[model samples]
Target: MADQTFDIEYVANLARLSLSDEEKQQLGSQLGQILDYIDQLNEVDVEGVEATAHPFPLVNVMRDDVIEGSLPHNEAMQNAPKKLNGLFQVPKIVE
Candidate 1:
């Protein structure tokens, strides 16, 4: 993995972040450790292991969509702070 080295300053510049020297050093070490763990995982044997998007089987848990009743316009507009001509009114938003 070509040593998986990280450049904290370069990454911060790319992200448009301004970090103190201490913060840069700390984040660099932390990210380095995370990359080392990933490298270690790459060394494990995976012979005969099947590749999968998910570790376990998944199923759609959503219920089927169905037509539903809607509230009457007058009833739905009852709580409006302002209404004009059977519709809600608001301040102008754009020029």
Candidate 2:
């Protein structure tokens, strides 16, 4: 932050921007002010602080799987639209 200056023309070229003289002067002052605030932030001490990817701790949100008895074969086939022998009779899928 010591003796820093915003190179308006150079930055404009890097960003592929075409700025007028008035616009360049206005933007240069604005960029300088933004950098001044960042320079002030650099004065803060962050000793022994751990960096985190997220603000809160991530956890597995899935519920535990519960094993339960399945319906009997006769009960399962009871609601079938079509049944043959003891199983559901589905339409032919292959020619």
Candidate 3:
């Protein structure tokens, strides 16, 4: 795990970054730990396990779609900044 030292210098070179010696060592160690964890996960036995996007079962709780009357044209346009013939008016953006 800790035996694998991350090529922090190479990564920094690619990212156009300048890191101090201490920072490089610290980041390299952290990256090495992450790789070690991934290696450990790779060793896990999931022969009978099902592949899933999430650990828990997901369900969408939805309400029934009911038909309803819409607001009257006058009431709907009461707070509008601009209005045309029974429609909301907007600034013209195209010729």
Please tell me which model should have the higher lDDT, number 1 or number 2.
Answer: 1
lDDT string, candidate 2, 1-95, tens digits = 72347688898999999999999988888887778777876778978878897889778878769888899999988989899999888889999
Given candidate 1, what's the lDDT at residue 54?
81
Candidate 2 weakest ten by summed lDDT? 1-10
Tell me, by TM-score, which candidate is best. 2
Per-residue lDDT, model 2, residue 18, is 100
List candidate 2 segments past 4 Å from native: 2-4, 47-95
Query: TM-scores for all candidates?
Result: 0.42, 0.44, 0.38
Q: What TM-score does structure 1 among the candidates reach?
A: 0.42
lDDT on C-alpha atoms for all candidate structures: 0.84, 0.83, 0.84
Error of 3 at 49 (Å): 14
Task: Give model 1's clash tally.
Answer: 0
lDDT of 3 at 40: 76
lDDT of 1 by residue, 1-95 (tens): 62446777888999999999999888887888887777877788999988898878778878669878899999999999999999899999999
Root-mean-square deviation (CA) per prediction: 8.6, 17.6, 11.3
Q: How many backbone clashes does candidate 2 have?
A: 0
